[model samples]
Target chain A: MSMPENEIREIEAFLFLEARLADESRYDEWEALWTEDALYWVPRRADLDPAKEVSHIYDNRQRIGTRIRQLKSGFRYSQTPASPMRRVLSNIEIAPAGADEYEAGANFMLMELAIQSTRNMNFWGGRTLYRLRRVDGGLRMVVKKILLIDADEPIANLSFLI
Target chain B: MGMQRTIVYDALVHRDRVHGSLYTDPGVFSDEMDRIFHKGWSFVGHTSEVPNIGDFKRRQIGLQPVIITRNPDNEVRLLFNRCTHRGNMICAKESGNTATFVCPYHGWTFGVGGEMRGVPLQNGMGKDFDKSAMGLANVPRMRIYRGFIFASLAAEGPSFDAYLGKARKLLDRACDMSPDGEVDLSAGWLKHRFHANWKMLPENNTDGYHVNVAHASLMRAVNAFSSQAFDEDKGDNSVTRDWGGGHTELDFAARYHQTGRPFQWFGGVPAAKMPDYVARMEQAYGKDLAQQHMIEGPPHAILFPNLFLAELNISFLIPISANEVVQYYTPLLLKGAPEVNARALRQTEGAMGPGSFLLPEDACMAERNQLGLAAQSPEWLDLRRGLEREYMDEKTGLLSSAVSDEITNRSFWKEYLQLMSSFPGAAA
Candidate 1:
């Protein structure tokens, strides 16, 4: 069955709002975007499913909450110099899974600038598969899986949310 | 008679600022290749990687490329990857299993053990061409300690065990965690390159002071979970522990301890199940050792030069250029572990994999450090934390530290200078 246009728009808005929250460093709000049983998954390999394959970031809601709290705490050394990031998300697609659950996909690019230097641009565009359910008449994510194109590539510290 | 300046072998003897050339100089790096990488026992790989006969893996020892293979006899051999006939690379792939390596350049083939097996045009060459003498050049020496393999390019140095010293316990503990007393390289590997000096990473890997500040995002994320699990007083005492040499442990302050933050970060275990896993670990390793492992947290031990042995996995940092480094990361799985346990371990590895939330923070920090250091201004990077408390232990050949000490950096610089100053012949 096709998802209603209004429902699709809600999913798109949720994705845009979530990305904005992360880019703005509003981690607490970003954490709130997920359900209590929500999962944040970034796979290591393109072929591996988050449910079956190992993922780079397979945090439950509790872990995600901790991550947000850590960002809020001033003790985090990597965050001391505050990495500023700008995210461009586009090509949103929404598909229905169940009566209230819908899967959403989008392409995104995150450009980070730190105190030390400029032009340290890291470009990554991936399909984010989100399992969304209508909660309190509003959509909340149950699982957000980010499958990066260069998922297997060695990476530096991924301090910020993508 | 004129007096001469005394030569110091110890890395700690230098008092004031080290020369800037040490960081930017090419000649100094070459010298490091000879004195440190070539002379010392550098980790090649684990024996489990090439468990079966004819299994082989290609690796780099400093700038020299080598192929480590297991022959039909189940003997592991480390040989230069170059073909004997025309210097063409024998094994181009990163890793594989093969009965023999055939050079594409001249079709000269060598056995898995690097023995010259055949030449395409055998009669074309006069009978005097000694095939045995023309076989692939073997690394100077290869040795294994509890399945971890190491190869030295130089013929002489302190034995691998003596060099590892107190750090052997870390390896021992890692291997002993498995019921079978061995660990194997599981699945594939993750490779990344950084536009930074390779030396900086080892120093940073063992640097505990940077954790609270450099990894604030990760710590904060982990800490949020901790705040609910434990009280304030328990969190305050969490500090970095020094394990002599350049090895340092970032002890999750007590508040985070209940959440098993260290295991969550290094072991990649889930926060929810940490308590159970810790209990299981305690039962396996006994209470005392488990306490030592847990309370001390995971030690990001830099085995001098460019190897970091963390609880989660093994990583080798190879200097590709003056300002570029290629890092190879592989997950370490306990041998003979149950499928469920292995799956859990692999899950943990995946959580902290290359695309992991934790790694991006680390990579960003490293890249930023490189960019910051590239500036023209002579800004002094601080290594003074707990400086007053740092003392050289006569027994372990390490600079000891309490919480948040920069002794790991100090020890690294100490070794760095020694490696930089010593000539190739001197190291030999």
Candidate 2:
């Protein structure tokens, strides 16, 4: 069965809002979008086991909070000035996963200026599998699993909220 | 005739400071690659990476591609990844189990041990080709101190023992954490690319002084460290140590031991949470020794040019250029401890890699420092921080001082200066 047009539009809007918060480095507002049981994963390989292998990021809810807090701290030089970022998200596919939940996949290409240090423009593109749920009248992210093009290879500092 | 300016490392490296050009000079970087990484020993992959025969992993020995594979005799081998037929990269995959590495360029197949097994057009060559002799070129020296592998490209220089020297104990300290006296590195590495001099990686990894400055974000965000900020007078016993022959450590053992609590070095993990890990350690070693192991945990040390025993993580840097480096980090998992290993994997993600809380700041600072080196007015970067207070450690008889000392930096420069100055093809 196909997802309703209205439901798809709502999901797309939520994803766009998330991208905007993350792009602008709005830590508090961005953090508010995640549910209590959030799983933020960025894997080195799409099929690797986290129990046996190391990943770029494998943060649970507590770790996600800690990550956001670290970014908010004034002394985070990696994000001191924050990388001036904007991203274009496309090819969004939304599907109903379960009761009051939707699994959405979108491709994003982010242009981030590493102004804090290198000042070189970094291009980051990845496919994100975001799991969202209907909360107390708004949508909250339950998962943000990013699969980067070069996740297994050497990658620059992703201290930003990717 | 125009004058040819010869680079002098002796003039640049001083007792209290070194020239800023050391970070920005391409010639200095080339010299270091030849002298340090090629001629001397550097850490390769661990044996656990390739358990059975035919298992292999790709590695680098100073920009030269090499493969770490297990031979038929179950011995560790370091094979140059170039093909025998033509100069083609033999192994393209990062890691896998393979019967033979077949070069797609010329159709030459090599065994797991890097022996040339077959030629596609055997009759085309005038029958003088010796298959037995035409194997992959092995690195001149290969040593396994515990399961950790290290190799040197140059045929002869220093003995691996002399190269490793007193720093061997650091490996022992890391391996002994497992009940089996083994450290498993089966977990794949997360490569972190940063814009900095290769030397900066080693210096910053164990810098006892930078935690409060560079990593103040993590400290403020979370109650991470044990409030043992580097004031010697504050009864905090952690020290910055120079373990002779360039190896250095920010030893938090004293701080962990002072608490008299097991696993203080491991984020104060309660023994009750890991019942099997605790029980196994006590079973293998005596109760006293195992308890002691728990207190000290793994060593947070830099083993000279490469390799970081970063407490619960293993890291090594691959120098790209004068201003670029790619550092690889993996969780230092124990051999038999499943519960502890699981925690270590998550901990490595939160603390070490590109997306982590702590390391990215260090990367940013290193990159900034490299950029700062471009200003030519101030010729020197000062290494004079705890020079007056440096004293000998009673046990190791090596120099050690407050956690916020330049003992480690000075020690690195001393060894570096010696190698660069005395190198065979140094500038005239």
Candidate 3:
């Protein structure tokens, strides 16, 4: 049976809002959308185990908090002249993962314009797999795995979150 | 009646400043590739990368394509990836296991040990063609020290030990930190590039003066993010040492931090897991050794020309041109300790990843520096911080300077001046 329209709409709204919050740099709101114990990972290479290989980002809640704090505290040199970003998330697919948990996969393309003393414009496209848990009748992200198309290539500074 | 002689690279470098053209000139970049990268012993890949027989890992050394493979006798061999037939690249895969690499162009195959084994059409070359005589050209010199592999293209040069000199101790310390007496490099790599001369990276590695300005934001954020207190200004608590042969080290304070743990950032590993991890380390290395390992912080060691070891990661620079360089950052794992390895991998990603907070700022600074070098107004870049405070060691013939000093850069330039002055192309 096909998923109900309401459920699909709910998933779409949730994903879009999450992307909007990140792009808008509303870090506190973004943090609130995550479950207490969350695993956020951006792999260096596709299909590599985090335990065996390295990742671009592999932060639990505390590590995530650290990154957020860095961004928010105005002390992150890379983000001093924080990049203005716009994220386009599409091709979203959602399905039940476990009890009260849903798995969502989506493709995203983010354009960021960073202006420090100089201006650097960056474009990044990636696919994201998110495991979201239903808490208090609302969906909260448990894990976010971002897989960039050119993970193995020698990329420039990706200071901003993808 | 005194005769005067001119040294080729003497004018390029000065006591406290170097010519800006040295950073932006393409001719200078090419000369560097030939004189420094090609002639010197540059790090290739580790032995653990191809542990099993017939396994191969591809590497490029100053435009020369090389393949590191495990031979049938279980020995490591470095071979040129070029095919003898048409010079097509033999192995394109970054890394894999295969007994024979068949050239797609003409079906010529070579063994993992670098011997030409088979040809699709044998009759074409005639029976007089010597199969055994034609094999892949081997790199002139290949040396393995503590599982780290370094390759030299020059036929004659100083021995690897002579080249390493006091820098060998840094490698030993990194290896000894592990209970197994060896470090594992099986973890994959993080590749990045910045718009600056490749030399800027090594200089930046030991350049403590820029910390407060270039990385002020990162330090401030890290301090604010963590519950633990930190002395962000680490200059007073550290020392920069020059170990000759362009090798230098930044030994930061171990007081505000613990070593051998991989992750130094506050809130790095879970608090409850710290004791258990320490217990595991103590169980494996005994109490005293483990204690020493924990207290003795990891030194940021930069081997002349290319290799750099920072904490649990070994990053090497491949100079593409005057303004572009590719960096391969491989996070090393402790062999026996899974927890430590896991932590190392995570922390390495956070520290060196493309999206890392620290390196991005450094990259921006490098790009800015490169752009600033183009300005003819300021013809020199200063390296004169704490120059007068440097003290030479009589025994090892090394130099030590304050942590905030640019002595590392000065020492590196000293070796650079020597090599570049003696360079064949420079003399020509």
Candidate 4:
């Protein structure tokens, strides 16, 4: 069912905040957006079963923390000089799931200047499905599944918050 | 007719050092495609991929496209992915279960076995055209050792047996992790493109020295590499072995056995997580052997030129050019252990992929190395770490050293030099 206008605005604001945090490489802030039982997945294909097939970024809460720690550690050379990235999200579709859970889908086109290795412009576009639940006060993401446009092909180092 | 073999490999590849040209020169890259890959046997794909007849997957040996197909007789056949008529790729799709490959370029159809089954307009062609001789060309040499398929395009060189030699144990160690003594690759491959030389993959994979330095972030974030063997000073446990014939291993079996623990190699995953798996292993190979297998886990080795039996994952690199390569990885899923296989898939994701915690650092380093190689000042890359400390192991009859030693690098170049120099002044 269609969500209320106020609810939609809150979800959009949360997604925008998450996107900005990730774009700026604000590891802790971006990580804080995730729930205790979080699943941040970047699957090779949308239909890929996590139990059967491997995804690019399949992190549980512990792994999410570890990923954040590594990024924040200052030694993750792949992002020592983090790639300057900007993503534009559009055509968002939001729907209420379970009790307080909401599902939001958005198409994003990210332009990353991959300064780590090749100082060339790397284009990354994908459809993301975000599962957000109302926590204590703010909404937290339970799942952030990214379906990259070129997921099935040979991929370069995507060590960013993408 | 005009082939200039100007590159003297003996001068470039030395015991303690190698020229940077090996990583940058286009001429050298072309030669490697022939001398090392095309002429020599290369790991194609696992047999478990094509379990039934008509199953097929697209593969590449060097740059030549080929198709790995299970024929009607239930035998694995490697067919060049060429339409016998117009030279278009017959099987363009990555993989599928197909009875026959029809070239969309025309109506020329070929059976899964690469036989020229039917032609659309045979009446138009000359009567002398022989369909029997017109089947898709097969790689002359093919061998399967413990379900790991290897193929060679050349008719003769080093036999697959000679190529494998003592290294067969590496495959054995990898396969025996499964309760059924077979590993599966059904999880699929993650192809990570690298803007670096192919040699970097083989050399860096088994180097062992770069782990602490290159993967410092991963070390900080994860408890996976809690092994003392990874530490430089405390070295008696994990050993770096040159398995002779180019095979090298950054062995952690000794370190795991010391703990008397199962799954230490697998990030200390408790045996309780996979009770059915443990019980199956115990029943299959008895308690003692199964415990030993559990303790040891899978092999962390690069099987010579390409295949990397990377503990719970299988990885291999396809060299594209002097400055480019694509490394593919898949979880080494155990045949009978669903629990272990599931974990292995997740582990592979966390360990290697482009976006993973560990391999991104490695990929970055490799690219930086490739970039730095453009400089003419640093003509050589040193491979002399732990030279004095390295010794000949009496048990395995191979050169052995500590984990951080450059013995693995030297071992690779030694075998590489032998293969390159075998055919004097032979141009690729």
Give the alpha-carbon lDDT of every model: 0.66, 0.89, 0.79, 0.89
TM-score-better candidate, 1 vs 2: 2
Per-residue alpha-carbon lDDT of model 2 for B1-428, expressed as tens digits? 96544688999999899999999998888888989999988898899999998899998988799999998889889999999887899899999998888999889888999888988889987689888998999988999989999988888888899988899899999998999999999899999998999999988887878877888888778875526456666787788999888899998878877778988767778899999999999999989999888988899999988899999999999999999999999999998899899999998998899999888988999999999889997889988998998899898777998888888888888888888888876753
lDDT of 2 by residue, A1-162 (tens): 897788788889999999999999999999999898999999998888987899889988898888888888788899989999999999999888888898989999999999999999999998999999999878999999999999999999999988
The 10-residue segment of model 3 chain A with minimum total lDDT is: A114-123
lDDT of residue B146 for candidate 1: 89
DockQ for all candidate structures vs. native? 0.31, 0.92, 0.60, 0.81
Cα misplacement distance, residue B154 of candidate 3 (Å) = 1.2
TM-score to native of every candidate shown: 0.75, 0.97, 0.91, 0.97
Instruction: Report, to 2 decimal places, the DockQ of model 1.
Output: 0.31
lDDT tens string, model 1, B336-424? 44442445444454434444434445555666666766674664555666677666656545455554566667666755665545544
Error of 3 at B258 (Å): 12
Model 4's i-RMS, to one decimal, reads 0.9
In the range B121-153, model 3's lDDT, one tens digit per residue, is: 889899899888788889999999989999889
Residue pairs that clash (backbone atoms under 3 angstroms), model 4: none
> TM-score of candidate 4 restricted to chain B?
0.97
Model 1 chain A worst lDDT window (10 residues): A113-122
Ranking by lDDT: 2, 4, 3, 1
TM-score of the second chain, cand. 1? 0.82
Candidate 3: global Cα-lDDT?
Answer: 0.79
Give the per-residue lDDT digits (tens) of candidate 4, residues B56-149. Answer: 9999999999999999999999989998787998887899999888888878888899998878888888899788888988988889888898
**Interface DockQ of candidate 4:** 0.81
Kindly provide the TM-score of model 2 when superposed on the true structure, using C-alpha atoms: 0.97
